[model samples]
Target: MSTELVSLDASKLAELIRTREVSPVEVVQAHLERIDAVDRRINAIVTVADDAIEAAKAAEAAVMAGRELGPLHGVPFTAKDAIDTAGVMTQRGSPIFKGRVPDTDATTVVRMKKAGGILLAKTNHPEFSFWIETDNLLSGRTLNPWNPDRTPGGSSGGESAAIAAGMSPIGLATDVAISIRGPAALTGVVGLKATHGRIPMTGIWPRVPRRFWHVGPIARSVRDVALAYSLLAGPDGADGFSTAPLQLDAGVGSSPGRPLRVGWLVDAFAPVDADVAATVRASAEALTSLGIAAEPVRIPVLEEINALELLWKLQVMETKPAFRKVTAGHEDKIFKHVQGVYDTPDTSIADFVDAEQKAEQLRDGFAAYFQRYDALICPVTTVPAHEHDAAEFDIDGQKVSSLHVMTATAPLSVTGLPGLSLRFGTSREGLPIGVQLVSPWMAESTILHLASLLEAVSPVRGLHPDMSRI
Candidate 1:
């Protein structure tokens, strides 16, 4: 019964609650019970909300009173620990901020609750949301629900695992480079990182490098993400970046009047795993099969910029100061992953300026690429979910540093473009593989429209990780 309750996407759950077919309390309790039963295997949820059942009760009372409901009314959702939740312990996966509780929700969290989505729990992450795998001094580590030996991906790893393991139908997650997309791909779920400014970042921590940070929804289905995006987007006047004047149309169960031109690039991040490469190709082929004009294409700046390095260089210049301030007199609280950042040499003035210039050019390059195609399909990571704390990755033939995992997704992060990650294939070991759908900044609808169509034809659409072993 708990499994069935937790399986419905947030959109369906909201509809069920709205019609009185299911009580919000039943929905919330089922998730809570599921987490209690399975979170032991994943370590994904660190703090279960003490008042989740009470919130569900309040939602039920409103329904009984015939109150008008918000879009997500009565749906339970989890938030990455890095995002603020009023009166909830948002320790940020660190002992430095142990017991820290925010006085208000982040803008995205505020919107989630405003839509009647009850806060269910806070998931784990790397300390300060910095690592490639979700292990920290505070909450330990999060494991992939598909296999215990494999990682769930980082920063937003716990959030992804919880949703994949059926502990939550959907969640709120943040991404600077690949937090949302990578983790979702590593697990088997759908995650959207909207155009940088489309969703406000107010009330989220580690605000340095603010322009690259995006808050969006991670769910089990495309329509649920679209529903969450509609509720979460728009300016709250608190964040300068959140000034997008237009709203996303979603365009679900619909298509554009013209044939949607599509492009796919796999070799740009050469040495990509054969499985990952095929998944990207399959995505493009799926689009072509639908009568969309699809073909191989490249954005020159991806090769020129080496975005994985550029993102680190650009972010280090801004992140170090914030780190110093937070860990001042508390250096003992720091973790190795974060300590590595402090050990890396600071960018020179010339190098920093050069990176900033390259970033603008990267954006221009993607703008030009989008002019030829409405959406681009690419690999979200070089390989499927790997084992935990590996020193390096073996991509195809060549062994590369762990950072290579971000090579495919970092370009979009640097450009502030909207991207979505959804499962389209499975690896030899049965791990889920995802493809990324990207579009020009603020035109999330185009990417999402393409995503919904791809989802319809996805070979692995309804496949879930076999969690029974764990």
Candidate 2:
């Protein structure tokens, strides 16, 4: 019974708590038991909150007193370690910040708590949340729940893994260049990266290059993601970039008159796995059954665009120096890939200016495309989850750079558009394949509406990783 309780989504859990069917204490205890049983093998959760049970007791009292509850009352959620949690260790997957506890919570964390959600644990991430895999010098590697030999995807990999394995029903995640969406794709869950300013990044690390960083929700269902987003979206005054107010209408895409026009692309990047491509096409076809006009459209910028090149250039010129200043004497403590950023040659002001110009062009291009289409559908990664410690892998008999994992996602990162990744299907190996649905800035509702529709027919829906092997 506890195992089944942990497996339900946040919405159902909240409903159970609202009525007399279940108490907050039982829900929290069930998840904690689930974590103890499985987290040893998955290694997704890094720090379990010490006060979680006490908080659950209080929440149970509130229910017993017949108090009004918030939308997520009594539901437990995990957070990526990159986000701040008051009195909880947020190591950011780096040893340098080990034992560091913030005096205050991040805006998202505070809002989640205010909405009656309990912070059960902090999930793992790569060092500084910089790498595509979830391994750091602090908490070690987080193995995929689906296949223990493969990664869960990162830097939000741990969040995805925990939710997928039923350690937590929902969680918060950060995304810059596929950190959130990529992991969701690999783990067969739902992840959202709303418009850049939709959620405040007040307490998240690496606040430099603020234009690309976004805080969003990762959960088993799109409605839960939407529920979390509604509570977390707003300006917090501390993050200057989070000034735009989101206008979300519950009925935006529900009207029969508002039929969606979606554009589908299977080859947004090179060396896409055949199965992954087929899943993207299949997702588009599924949308067609719901009165969506799914069409094959090409965005020319993607053909010539090197997303990583632009990303590295921008980071080297704008964000790297600021990061270096913060971690000056702790060079040896940082992850090797992150240290390589400091070792690499710095970009000139001319090159930096050129990259910024090109980014604007890409954003403009996507904006134009949105004018013709409600959303664009594409692969989240070139292949499904790969083996651990793999620097490079083969796709369709062709050896490709390991960085190809970021190929489909980095372009959207540059554009600061809203993107959501949801489980579309599975690979021949029984691994999950996710497709990204992207829309113009501040148009998260459009993509989410489409995602909710896809969720209704997803082949991998209600599927859980077989943990008995672990």
Q: Choose the strongest candidate by lDDT.
A: 1
Model 1: ten consecutive residues of lowest lDDT? 247-256
lDDT of residue 152 for candidate 2:
92
- Cα lDDT of candidate 2 equals 0.89
Task: Go through the candidates in order and give the clash count of each.
Answer: 0, 0
| lDDT of each residue in 1-470, candidate 2, tens digit only | 79889889999999999996999899999999999999999999999999999999999999999999999999999999999999999998888899999999999999999999999999999988888899988999999999999999988999999999999999999998889999999999999998888899999988867788989999999999988888999899899888877664222455576577889997658789999999999999898877787989999888866877888799766667876886789978878768867788989889888888888888878878877887899999889999987888888789987888899899988988888999888999999999999887787788888899999988778999999988
Candidate 2 has which clashing residue pairs, if any? Answer: none
User: What Cα-based lDDT does every candidate model obtain?
Assistant: 0.90, 0.89
lDDT of 2 at 291: 71
Cα-based lDDT at residue 224, candidate 2: 94
- Runs with alpha carbons beyond 4 Å of true place in candidate 1: 248-256
Instruction: Kindly report which residue pairs in candidate 1 clash with one another.
Output: none
